[model samples]
Target: IPHLLELMGFRSSAYLSHMRTLKTLEQIGAAASCRVGREDILYQFDVLREYVPVVLPLMLANVLCPSVLPEEVATAREHVLEVQQNIGENTESLLCELLHITAYRGNTL
Candidate 1:
């Protein structure tokens, strides 16, 4: 179960890394990131209107056809674990997580 959670968290990083290396976002002067909510995952970007034509297809490709290479996965896994550890050590973060659990009742938030 923990492994699955880690994979879910890491996969977005892996995908983003793949896209960045391929110059999909940077070449078009766009910035992109992923967010995972309780019920949904979002892949979002900001780019100039003129650059949209160049970035949109690349973004779609990254989303529709992800290539989570082993190296990216390894790096993302390490990053996710480090972040999780940092959050664990932060009292405010722990309280926020507890608040979510209590307020959401383990349902989607």
Candidate 2:
């Protein structure tokens, strides 16, 4: 039982890491206006956005409830928020570039 639990824990950790990487790439692509060749990246981003907040709180519940661990939660939350902010800023820049590209394309046509 203990060994099984350990294996499950490792699997969960690996899954989380993979999810985070995919999410980061999506944010970068959205921000940079660089098209992602893989559809899976976008799908993963959608899933992560839906579940990350809930999963995060559950994952840290033991450390957060009754008494808050401000430092750990704050750090994690900040990192997430920073990623979101970066994506927003990047998205705006990408939109501007896209507009310019569209205008140029229209002019050429």
Worst 10 residues of 2 by lDDT: 34-43
Please list all clashing residue pairs in model 2, or write none if there are none: none
lDDT of 1 by residue, 18-49 (tens): 53534756576677666665666776778899
Per-candidate TM-score against the hidden true structure = 0.68, 0.21
Q: In candidate 2, what are the lDDT values of residues 2-36, reduced to their tens digit?
A: 22222222111313442453365465442211122
The C-alpha lDDT values of all candidates are: 0.62, 0.39
Candidate number achieving the greatest lDDT relative to the actual structure = 1
User: Which runs of model 2 end up more than 4 angstroms from their true locations?
Assistant: 1-68, 89-109
